[model samples]
Target chain A: MKKLVQDDIRTGVFICDCGSNIAGYLEMKELVEFAKTLPNVVFVQENLYTCSEGGINEIKLAIPRENLNRVVVASCTPRTHEPLFMSACEEGGLNPYLFEMANIRDQCSWVHMREREAGTQRAKVQIAMAVAKAAKLRELNRIQLSLSHRALVIGGGVAGMSAALALANMGYEVDLVEKRDRLGGILNELNMILPSNEPPDKLVNNLAARLHDNPKVTIHTGAVVTKTEGYVGNYVATIRQNENENKIKCGAVIVAIGAQPLKPEGLYNYDGKKVITHIELESKLKQGDVQAKNISIIQCVGSRSKERTYCSRICCMTAVKNAILFKEASPDTKITIFYRDMQMYGVENEQLFRKSKRLGVRYVTYDPDRPPRFDGESVSVHHLRMGRDIIVPTDLLVLSTPLVAQDDASEISTMLKVPINENGFFLEGHVKLKPLDFATDGVYLCGNARFPSTIREAISQGLGVASRAAGVLSKEALFTSGIVADINPETCCGCLGCVAVCPYGAINFIENRGICQVNKVLCKGCGGCAATCPSGSARLDGFSNQQIYAQIEQAMAV
Target chain B: MSDSQFEPKIVGFLCNWCAYAGADLAGVSRLQYPPNMRTIRTLCSATVGPHQILKAFQKGADGVFVGG
Candidate 1:
């Protein structure tokens, strides 16, 4: 890393037209002339496309010729183009962190296309601000930490087991933890799975057998993760079982603790015997303990309500699958399914729905406002399509309730420093791009822990999380941002204001020195601690007090 | 009407994650607004100190917006 001294603060500003995206709306020539007047701006140039190869070469050649220590690009957003410009600076024998970006295209030209005069003036002011900030830019160093090759897989269900098997197949050591004495989770109570009509036991047993036989896999039953510490590439987990506690160090963690089935007790007149949840019915069917002639299955129980507004992704299919099983077992028995909407997604599930209809399974659509009433021995539902009431004498009532998040979800979320949605599901980084990964770098989520999913969806997410975790564990070392918060011992009075406001718990008071300190590795460079410090003692490295004030002062310049 | 139009000189501090993306989206969608604001991009909203806002106001900014 190169230290940019005050005497060598020569900043070269480059303006890009973006092939008329910016030039069409604002005058580039006038903006370049305006940039040269700013302090420390030794060179100013305009390009047709600043991100192009020729434009990058022009910047590389100008650094040594102009004696430029800091480079500023007045163009597109820094979110997408900052890295490209930073790498270009590094190639030009300058510190990458010394480069600053001003979003003239997104914030100025493109926003004020009709008002060209105002747009040009705004672009000039933005360039001035960039030059002012560039004068105070400092070089930053990247911190690298070695990674542990092992992984910790929480939960021993099909999702957890599948992830463990995949990681173990990749020649990585895996520790699988289950809170119960057995391996299978909710799958243990399930009789048959959807789309295949196959016994879930077969799938669960297959995963359990492979996990047990794998030399790289270690199974820990009746255990819970008591504590977790450290960041990505290095995480220490303390697991406790019975009266013993064990510590495991791993690079990545996959949370597949799954979810518990919702039990609508008083809502559906459920007595746990006559009117019961789908989970209870499934266990009874598995043991051949249920006997009924007339069965009524209700969908969206305790889900898609005002309180829990999210759709339980797999409840409708489960209801259809169970209804088909009952019809197949006793052809004379009448099975009716009352639903708001049939969520039979995918080709296989739609085919199963059609097959169930052909096998004499009756379906009745009901309104959410007028729900079905279970009057002791029968269920009366207000049919939406018919616009009338239909009463069915129910011998057995099965409510297909949505899966609720585990009780320990919030506790686990706090321990891992990951976020949970309002519905209590673990929030992924991105719904589409990063489905199995958490916002936190090393942690991953899958299965019902994120949302209610089928056995197939859960298994697919399990494999996806395994691949994501392997990507992190495969790296030799991890590099973190260098623009972390730094506390000045001379100005710090140990007020602990920064310590109280730090969301990441990165700030701590040094009792011996009577000053606050920051863990640079844990600090995300968010600047929360620095902003909350009353004494102005805490400061971010690259974005210091002088750098921001300079930009603010330049913004107000005539 | 007055000879000089009163254009509000606003200083905006936009966070890189959401607000910056939102501003870029507005430009991409060709949405128009008053061209009276100057933006300073930061890594996060938590990075913008109280002094930064006070400094903008002291430097003759009519309004200030802090976005995350």
Candidate 2:
């Protein structure tokens, strides 16, 4: 009854040559030789490229041959190879999560080519840690969430409205929460959107009206989500409306809160009159600004290096839009755009750039290191292309700055249990493939919340996220990861340390056993809990440190 | 926890709006910060949680920061 489970836990350790990537610095032969010495290692092998199909086949062949239930591949970061090895284990009739990956290629050999001995030693240590975690990994079971069919979108901006309309059209019930007294977000204030030459108010109204009559969409105006608790499959959101926080629970949440305009407060001389922002310039254009013969529009303010360090992406287009507008209004107006690099990607935008130039809008290049100086009624710019300091007489100076995500993004991120990028925008899993998704399983984020996007991009993102949310909520019993976190209550100390550190709130302290319990549905398998558990009470299934240790020790020994 | 003046009662209103996740990232990155501030989460940058940041200041907080 008190058996070590050592007999039950059999492991196969494979050392990879990794083409020449790892073999150039690592000695694979000796590593394979050391594998046989480990306690639970039943099979030891060396592969030219363990990530290769032949290597995966070798792993599959060894599993049955050695009765291995655990596998550790000492090669590269799991980000690249963990899946291949796991699939091999699964084919061999073992749980997929019961495997651990050791990063010897990128994290070790590549970084320490000159210090091979030290790299191998560090690899050994890392493998030891992984194996210790993997040895205690139990068989994992699939997590199924009983999901509600409704979706909640926070924000009334172009992105949020688009998301609402998309989900509503798809026959999914949607609750759209907007903080402002009216919907339409920033789009409501715009006279005409760039490039399209369409009225923004009409589009904003059309989307809002469509969502209103859909019967599936519930519009919450003057509302704010003050408290957010829970995770995917089931989330409890408390929204404040009419000076009251209304609690609503839903299956999925979409954060489409668009960014605000970066104000020009102290930068240069912002009298809100002469030196105004791009947004102010929009209003100025609409309000019929008094005639000025020369107009200078500065690009990349508060964005794309040192200060912001991320391309706002839309500013250049805005500058071109304003320049074209000014040219159309006053053809005699000398419209100059100060830019670092103009990112006019799509064909239509490129055409717009040409159109603006043909219309007498002048383009000037300036180094970000040396910004063009603004002196009351004139402009002093270092003409990098011309190799001279040029002074251009200007009437109105417009600083085209970035539109940042709503100020409430961090709170919304916490409530959603999602991750945001370094620039404070929501981190999509892949920048291109899954642009609307968060790393957290069921939550989706889009629009300026991720980065500064134009109205067109925001609408596209809204529809895109709505489609993603529809996919998960459509199913009655949503299939989550079969790879759930495993814990050995017998080893737990009831410190609740792991529970406290969980960002997802998946780990909870149970009274009966006096140990932390993992809510499989909510656990993202980020390993934050296992990393925090001081008593070694909770161990992830298939990721015991022993298996990882054996693989690493064997790799280093070779 | 706030009884001692040495106990930095740094009451931080991390706007569910922005700063909370920044703090979380700082935590995940193991970013070393002064352990004086206790964060009270809020939904929006506009929605201050029950006058908590001000309360922290009143409760002898040396500095206050709002994240959203």
Point out where model 2 deviates above 4 Å.
A1-79, A97-138, A169-171, A266-269, A273-275, A287-296, A300-311, A334-343, A363-397, A410-435, A467-558, B1-68
Single out the weakest 10-residue window by summed lDDT for candidate 1 chain B: B1-10
Best-matching candidate per DockQ: 1
lDDT of 2 by residue, A1-558 (tens): 112337767878788888887788766665666555555667778889988889999888888888888888888756456667887899988888778766566555666666666556555544543444457666666766687888889998989998888888888888999999888887765656767797777887788788888899889999888876776667788988987878888878898887788896787687788888888877766777657788898888778867678888988988888788778877988988889899898999999999999999888989978999998988899999789899989878889888876678887787676787776788887888788888766789888888888788888888899889988878889766665555678898889877877766788788987878998877765455665677666654433334323322332232
Per-prediction TM-score to the true structure, in the order listed: 0.92, 0.69
lDDT of 1 by residue, A22-120 (tens): 999998888988887777778999999999999999899999889899999999988889989998998999999899998999888888989999999
RMSD of each: 3.3, 12.4
Q: Residue A514 deviation, candidate 1, in Å?
A: 3.2
Worst 10 residues of 1 chain A by lDDT: A1-10
